[model samples]
Target chain A: MSERAAAGIRIERVVKIFGDVGITALNEVSLDIAPGEFVSILGPSGCGKSTLLRCVAGLDTPSKGQIVVGGVPVSAPPEHLGIVFQRDALLEWRSVIDNLLLPIEFRGGDSRAVRPHAKALLRMVGLEGFEDRYPSQLSGGMRQRVAICRALVDDPMLLLMDEPFGALDALTRDQLNIELQRLWLANRKTVLFVTHSITEAIFLADRVVVFSPRPGSIADVIHVDLPRPRKLAVRTSELFHGYAGRIRTLFEGMGLLKEDE
Target chain B: MNRQSLQGVAITTMTLIVFGLIWEAGVSYFGVKPIVLPPPSAILRELFSELPWYLGHAWFTLIVTLGGFALAVVIGVALAVLIVESKLLEKTIYTVIVGLNSVPKVAIAPLFVIWMGTGAEPKLAIAFLIAVFAIVIDTVLGLKSVPADILDLGRALRGSRSMMLWRIRFPCALPSLFAGMKVAISLALVGAIVGEFVSSQRGLGYVILSAQGTFDTARVFAAVFLLAILGMLLFAAIVRIERWALPWHASQKDYSPSA
Candidate 1:
C-alpha cells in the first residue's frame, strides 16, 4: 500500500494452541504488511483476531510458524514496535507525561531527548493541556489519547493497536479515527489495528484482513483503494458502503454475523 | 472547628467529666477505702506524681511492640512473596498458616516464655506471632488481586519479572499492606502487654501486677491509663505514616471525620 519495497510484518503460517487440550486459538494465519501501510484485521468476537495480533507483537509465542518484523524473526517484543491495548492501561500512580515516559525508560532510551518528541506527539493527538493530569482525572477518550501518545513516544517503527478505540462511545471513536488518520498521514508508521467494527476497518485501513471464527484462519484480505485523508463524511460515501458490504459478506459466509444484521 | 466536630469534642469532654465525677462521688459516698475503688482524683494525682517511673515502663513496652511489629512485617511479606511466586509452596504452606492463625496467640505466650525465658525476648516473640499471620494473609490477597489485564499489559510491554513486581504488583498491593499493618499494630500492642502479664520485670503490665498485689487501686488505674494512652499514640502514628505514604488513596482525599 505504501509502494515500499521492504515488508514491515511477515507472518508465515503461524499457529497457536492453549495447553494440552489442543484447543487452537489461531491456525495457519499468514499475512504480510508493507512498510508505512495501515492494515486492519477485522473479525467478530471469538474469531482469534486478538490472538493473531498478540503473536505478531511477540506477546504470545506461536506454536508453529514464524513472525518476522522488519526482516527479523520476532521471538520477543522488539523495542521499535509500540502496542496500544483496548483499555487505556495507564499507570494510576504516574502523571500523564510519566505514563508516556514508561516504555522509553524500559528500553533504556534517553527520556530527556524524547521528552520534546513526546510533547509533540501529545499535541498531535490533541492532548496539549493534559500533561499534568493523572489518568483517573481524564475521560475515557482522553485517557485513550494519552495511551496512544505513550505508544508513539519511543518513535516506534510499527504501531500494533488491539481495538484501542473499542471501549469508547461512537462519537468519541469517530473523532479519534479522524485524528488517527491525520497522525498516520504525518508519521507514516506501519500500523496493524484489530477491530470488531466493519465501518472502522473500512474507513481507516489501507487493507482489511478478515478472519474466520474460533481456531481462526485468514478468510480474506480486502484492499481499500479509497482516497487518503479520510473524513467523517467519507464514511457516508458509496465507496465506504461497498467496502463495508464486502466485509459483511465475508462475516456472513463464515456464519459469524448475528447481532448487527 | 466545624459545628459537628465542636459538638463531638464537647460530647467527649462531657462524657469523661461525668464518668470521673460519678466515680469520685460513688467512692466517697459509699465509704470505699483507698485500697479498693479509689476515687478518680486520687488516681490522677498518683499518675502525675509517678510520671517518670510510668514513662520508663511505657518506653520498654513501646520498644517490644515496635520490634515485634517490624519482625512480623518482614517475615510475613517474605513468606507471602514466596508463596505467591510458587504454586507448590502456596498449596502446602497456605493451609499451615491458616491453621496456625486459628490457634489463640495468647495461649502460646506461656510456651514462648518457657522457650525464650522471662525477658523482652518472649514478649517480642509473642507479639510477632500475633501480628505476622494477618500481614501474610492480607498481603497475599493484595498481590493476587492485581487485575489480569494489568499483568497482561506488563507482559505485552516485555517487562522483566522484577520490573513487573516493582512497577505493577508492589504498588498495587500497598493499600492492602497498610490495612494489614493497621490490624497488626493493634495486635502487636496487645501481644506485648499479654507477654508482660506472663513474665516481665519492667513494663506497664508489671506495674499493674505489682499494684494489684499490694491492693493499690489508684496506682493500678494510673498504670491502665498510661497503657491506653500508649496504644492510642501508636495507632495514631501508624495512621499518620499511612497518610504520608499514600497521598493518592481515596480515604486520604478531603477526608475530615468529625473529631
Candidate 2:
C-alpha cells in the first residue's frame, strides 16, 4: 500500500508450510494494506492467495512471520472479522435476516438489537423484501448479496472474501462486482479479496496483488488507478484493458495463460 | 417413477382393497375354515365385536411403544451427541451399539420379562433397545453430512462446539433423525409386541396369543390389523414431524399432499 497502516493490514514475511516435509504454500510473502483500502489478491489455482487471506482472517496460521491487524496479532478469529467464501455459506434453515445475525449470535450479543440495522443493510444491497426468504428461495446472485450483507452486518473493519463471486455466472459476477464497489465506496472497509479472475481483481480493487503457484509467492502487484463507484463500463475501458493485459502477461510469463491470448 | 407422488396414495388404497377382495373370494370359493384362513369380512366382524377388547389391549401396546420410543429418542440423541463430540466415545459407542443390535432381540424379550416383571416395563425396555440403534446411526450420518465449506464457515465465524452442534449439526441432522424415527417407531411397536408374545397379562399381542390358543383365527387377524394401524399412524406422525420441523430441507420441497 502507498499509505502505511492506511490499508489496515500488515503481513510481515509470512510463510506457510504444509505437512512434515514442509511443502510451503506462501514463502516469506509480505504486504501492507492501508486503512479502508480495497485490495484484491489475484492468483492461479493452488496459489497461496487464499492462504494469505486466511492468515489475515486467522482461519489459518503462518509457519513463520506474523500478520498484524489493527495493531494486534491475529492469534484466533478476530472478533471484528467478517469472511465470505466462494460458496454462499448461508444456513438454509434460517431466513436471510437470521443468517445476517449469525455473527452477532456467535459473539453472544443481542441479535434483535441489530434488526433495524440488518434491514437497512438488506435495503442497501437491494434485498429489502427478501429478508423473510430462505437461502433456497433466493437466486444465486441474490444469495451472494445476502452473504455480502451478512459479512458487513458485524461491522468488521476488515472484510476477507475468497473468490466470493467465482461461483456465479459472468453477468451475475459483473453485477455483484458493481454492487461490491458501491458498498466499498460507501463504507470503505479494508477488503482483502482473493480471486483467480484477473479482470475481477482489476475491476474491484484499489491495488491488485498477483501470486505465483507452487510455494506461492507474490509475483507482481498492480495499482488500479480507475475511478471509484465503477460500473461494468469500466471493464471495457482502454485503461482497464491495459491493467488486465499487464496482469495477463505476468501469468503468461508463469506459463499459466494459454496462447489463445 | 414418481412413486413418492400424491397419486401413489390412490395406488396404495387400491392395492389394499384388491388384496382384501382376493382373500375374501379365495376363502369363500374354497370354503376354507376361518380358523385356518379367515376372510377379510370375518376379520372385520371380529374387529367390530371385539372393539372394546381390542381398544383396551391396543392402549396398553400404544403406551408401551410410546414409552420405548420416547426413551429411544432422548437416549439415542444424547448418546449420538456424546459419540459425535468425543473421539473416545465414538470409537467405543458405535461398536457397542452395533453389537447390542446384533444380539437376537427375540431372545432378549424374555430376559426383559424376567428382569422387569410381566408388566409394560419389559415391553418398554425391549422397544427402546430395538429402536435406539436406528436413531443413533441415522443421526450420526445426518450430523456428518454437513459439507466441509459449511463447517469452515462455522470455524471462520468462530462458532463454538455447541453452536456448531445446535445451529448447524442438529438442524442438519433432523431430517435424518426423522428418517431414523420412522424406522424406530415400527421397530419399537414390533418390540413391544414381541415382549407381549413372550409373557404379558394384557396387550394386543396377548390377545393374539390367547386367540391362537382358542383357535380363534379371526380375532388374531383382527389384533394384527390393529397393530398395523398403530404402526402406520406412528410412521405417518413421524413423517409429519419431519416435514414440519425441516421446512427448509430440499427433501421436503416436493409439496406432496402429505406435506
What are the Cα lDDT values of the candidates?
A: 0.86, 0.88
Question: How do all models score by TM-score?
Answer: 0.87, 0.94
Chain A TM-scores in order: 0.94, 0.95
Over B120-238, each residue of candidate 2 has an lDDT whose tens digit, in order, gives: 79999999999999999999888889877788778878899999999999887887898899999999999899989999889999999989999999999999999999998898888
> Cα deviation in Å at residue A91, candidate 2?
0.7
For model 1, the stretches where C-alpha displacement exceeds 4 angstroms are A1-7, A258-261, B1-46, B86-96, B215-221, B250-259
Give me the displacement of residue B31 in model 1, in angstroms: 9.9
Local accuracy of candidate 1 as per-residue lDDT tens digits, A202-256: 8999999988887888989999988888878988899888888888888778776
For each predicted model, how many residue pairs clash, with residues at least 3 apart or on different chains? 0, 7
Stretches > 4 Å off in candidate 2: A1-7, B1-11, B254-259
